[model samples]
Target chain A: MKKMMYISAVTEALAEEMERDESVFVIGEDVDIDGGVWNETAGLLERFGAKRVVGTPISEGAFTGLAAGAALTGLRPVVEFMYGDFIHVAMDQVANQIAKARLMFGGQAKMPVVIRLCACGAGTREGAQHSQFLESWFAHLPGFVVVAPSNAADGKGLMKSAIRSDLPVVFVESRQIYYDIQDVPEGEYTVPIGKAEILRPGEQVTLLSFGYACEKARQAAEMVKDKVDVEVIDLRTLKPLDTETIFKSVEKTGRLIVAHDSPAMCSIGAEVVRRVVAERFDYLDAPPVVVASKDVPIPFNDELEDYTVLSVQDIVDEIMKISVGII
Target chain B: MKKSSVASPSAEYFYRWMLAIRHSEQKLKELYIDHKIKGALHLSIGQEAVPVGVCAALSDGDKVFSTHRSHGHYIAKTHDIEGIMAELLGRATGCSNGYGGSMHLYNYEKGFLGGNGIVGGGISLALGAAFSAFYQNNGQIGVTFFGDGAANQGILHETLNLASLLKVPFLAVCENNGVAATTPVEKSTSETDRTKLAKAYKISSLSADGSDVEAVYAAASKAVAHLRAGKGPFLLNLRTCRWEPHCGIIKDTRDQKMLDDWRTNHDPLNVIAGRYPELLSSELRAEIGREVDARIEAAVAEAMTAPAPELAEYKRNFGV
Candidate 1:
């Protein structure tokens, strides 16, 4: 294993995938010469030339549609929406065209397209329009496998797996942890899409989360380790959700708290809580708690943004509350 | 009304195709009125020359993206009238296995990438297909067929700009039928001369008489050459006329005189039949018409008897 930044892990995955398969190409705004808006695709153009790495106009609809057509034709296209909020602009292509192509065509089409979205709200001063964690929209879409990688290792692994998959995948990466260093396996490896990783083994409370917020849950678990045995689960895949892992953890701990950066209503947390209540009601010691952002647009002010979204302290408090009753 | 003095392979086949499409639309109209076929239908009755001319220049490997009025485009590309009729009838053996009706006809094996219901939606998809052709280094090109109404969509301009910038092998064909559904181009768009819009993106553009099969074929030939030479994207504006309503069995409610004038003077079938009566003699026309009728009937019979798709298959594609 080698230590690397989350951004480096992303770039490394692109390079490795492009090298492994000639059909893989990257298309998005500022991806070619500009090396992506956040430099997540740096050195790709130099390594693969202009044919493999193409910079497109700011028209998300066109590029996203183009990526879909490219995927249908033969090439595996990894398209990037510079910001997660911009996914709204490309919704027609994503929801109407690409998402329905496989089923609408009677399974003749395998849409091997990966959409890399820089997602998550709070901590970024980019305000309401640019900062929004909208993975719920894609997770709800049919014919789409949504995955969010929290650390460098899963970031690289999930990206590789996403590129290789025969179905459409929305690989949601976080802007908040782009520079955070983590130990990633050197060379080639892939983490499966529909599986969750158990970050800590405990019996008192179960904390469930994905993406950059998963780090906060793990940290929160560590903070209350002396007083409570907290089990942290990183739900790497949102769709085809790793319900087996979630159910098993809930059964062991008998308490659950779901955390995410997106607003609480109609979010991933709601789905998790609903499923646990419906199927795993016998396993719960108390009603499942949810730690999520308030259902309000993220504010521009740093302090207001902090208040609007979840934090490590929020997860720690939720776990502590659940632990007191469970024990 | 200039006609091609010389009769070649395309001339003979073009006349037959125009006749086939015209007769097929007439059959569809009859079926809808008889309550045999259901759902929205966009007939390319008077605009057969545009697809025939454009597809004449395309190789078997080239991909074609289409709009809702896609029967002519699919027939022109694949020459599978039976399959198309079965698809329109929503059969188990249809191109999309009865899942896609009129607006969603796809035959990837024959290089017909199929049609989308949204206006101007196919443009970007076609551009992406062209990008794939370029990426694969397989010498394949992408073609998109949208009407004049679709030209006004913002995505069309965006696609045009990017196609020019990328220098990919693509052709964006605009079937300027002077109407977008019921709205005339003059009412919805400022620049009625739609080909001029390509100039803004610095892409090569051409204007063709869509009613004149010879003219459209000539323009398409030049476009194929331009694209083959790696000259980026080319926009072809085929100013044709739509004989039927934008959708359904409803006859056009537009100006009767204008429709009559076009049917008389600008109908591609009439133009070809009038220009070369000897080539399309009564006997020859009757034979082709019977062939098309038989094909459509066989397809309809098969489709009417074919069972609906299995629930398991539907669920699999639904990915639920």
Candidate 2:
């Protein structure tokens, strides 16, 4: 096993995948010579050369659509959207073309494209544009497979799986956890796209989250361990969600709390809560809760951004509220 | 119109294809009026030469991405009228299995990528295909066909810049049909000369009389040659006229006199027939028209009887 940061793990995965498959190439703004704004694709240009590691002009829609086109013609293109918010610039290509290409073409085409989005959290004070977790937008789309890993190992494993999948995958990364280090397995290993990991097991209530919020959920679980037994689940894949794991944990705990850094209204957390309520109504001890950011643009100030986003205290408080009498 | 040294065989081939597309479109119009084919139908009635001419310059391995008014492009590229007919009829035998109607047609095996619903949507896609061909060192090229209206879309300029910078084997064929939907090109942009769009990007540009099949074919051949020689991308603007409305069975809102003048003087079929009377005589043209009509009828008959796509098949496409 080798210890690496979350960002390095992503870079390692891209390098390994490019080495393994000739068809796999990297394309985006400043991804080649600059190695990416976050260095998530560092050293790819030298290793893969200019043909495979392309540094595109700042035309997101064109390059994104170009990547989709390349994917259609038997090349696997990994598109990097410098920031998660920049997906809006390429939404038509992302939501309309890439996501709908396969099914709209009657499954005649295989869109094996991976769109890697970085800087997907609020605490760094990048303001509304740069610091938004928009995975729910992709999760709502039908054809896309959305995956957000919270740590190094899952980051490496999930990225490999995403690159090899026949369908288009959206890889959401958080700047908040880029430097967070963890032990990734040596050699080759892949985390399945639709599987969730049980980070911590307990019996009182279930705390499910993804991306950087998973780290917060763990902290919240640790804080409430003496008063309430909490089960923390890292939902690695947002769509084709690991509902089996969620349902099993909710069924065991008899209570649920879905958390994420994205907004509360019409969010992935809401979808998770809805599913648990609809399917596991009999298994519920109390109403399922969604601990998410407020439905507003992220502020530029550090304190204001923290207020807008979900905090560890918020998860702990929600857990205490739901486990009041049960614990 | 400049005279061309096009051969007799090529002239006949172009005439036959133009007639087939014209007849198929007219048949589709009749079917729509008779409540046989439902949904939006955008016909390239007078603009058949653009697709036929451009496709003539492309090999079977070359990719062609087209716009919503793409029946002509699909027919010209793949000659799979029955498959496209089935698709328009929403049948399981359709090219896209009834999922995509008139606007979305894809036949990958025949190198026809698709006809996009959005304006300028296929430009970048074609660029990618061209990029793939260049990256793999394959002797293939990518061609995208869009109307004048789509030329104003931001994606077109963006793709042009990218294609020029990347030096991919890409060809952008803009069929300037005078108007975009209902808005005239004069009203849409200050620079009505669409060729300047490519020229600004430092890419090679060419203009052709879209109504003249020989001229369009000649221009397309030049553009294809330039692309094949690793000369980056080339933009060919085919000045044509749209006989039908932008979409559906809507009445043509343009000036009737202008439309009549175009039909009389600039009709692609008449232009070809008039230019090549020795090859496409009145009697020969009549025979080709009859054959095309019969094929369209047979395709319509087959599509009308084909089974509708099953719900289970659609559910299977949903990966979740």
Instruction: Give the best candidate by DockQ.
Output: 2
Q: Which model scores highest in TM-score?
A: 2
Q: Lowest summed-lDDT stretch of 10 residues in model 2 chain A?
A: A32-41
TM-score of chain A of each: 0.97, 0.98
lDDT of 1 by residue, A1-327 (tens): 999999889889989999999999998888986678788899999999988898888999889989998998988999998888888888878998888887677678779999989755567788989888878989888779999998999999999999999999998888889989989999998999899999878888889999889888988988888888888999999998899999999999889999999988888889999999999999899889889988888888878988888899998888877777444
The 10-residue segment with the lowest total lDDT in model 2 chain B: B1-10
Clashing pairs in 2: none
* Cα lDDT for residue B210, candidate 1: 96
Local distance difference test, per candidate?
Answer: 0.86, 0.89
What is the C-alpha interface RMSD of model 2? Answer: 0.8
Question: How many residue pairs of model 2 clash at the backbone?
Answer: 0
- Across A1-327, the per-residue lDDT of candidate 2 in tens digits comes to 898988989889999999999999999998876778888878888888999989999999999988999999999999999898998998878988999888878889889999999888888877889888889889888898999999999999999999999999999998889998889986688999999999999998999999999999999999988888899999999988899999999999999999999988888889998898889999999999999998899999878887898999999899999997876
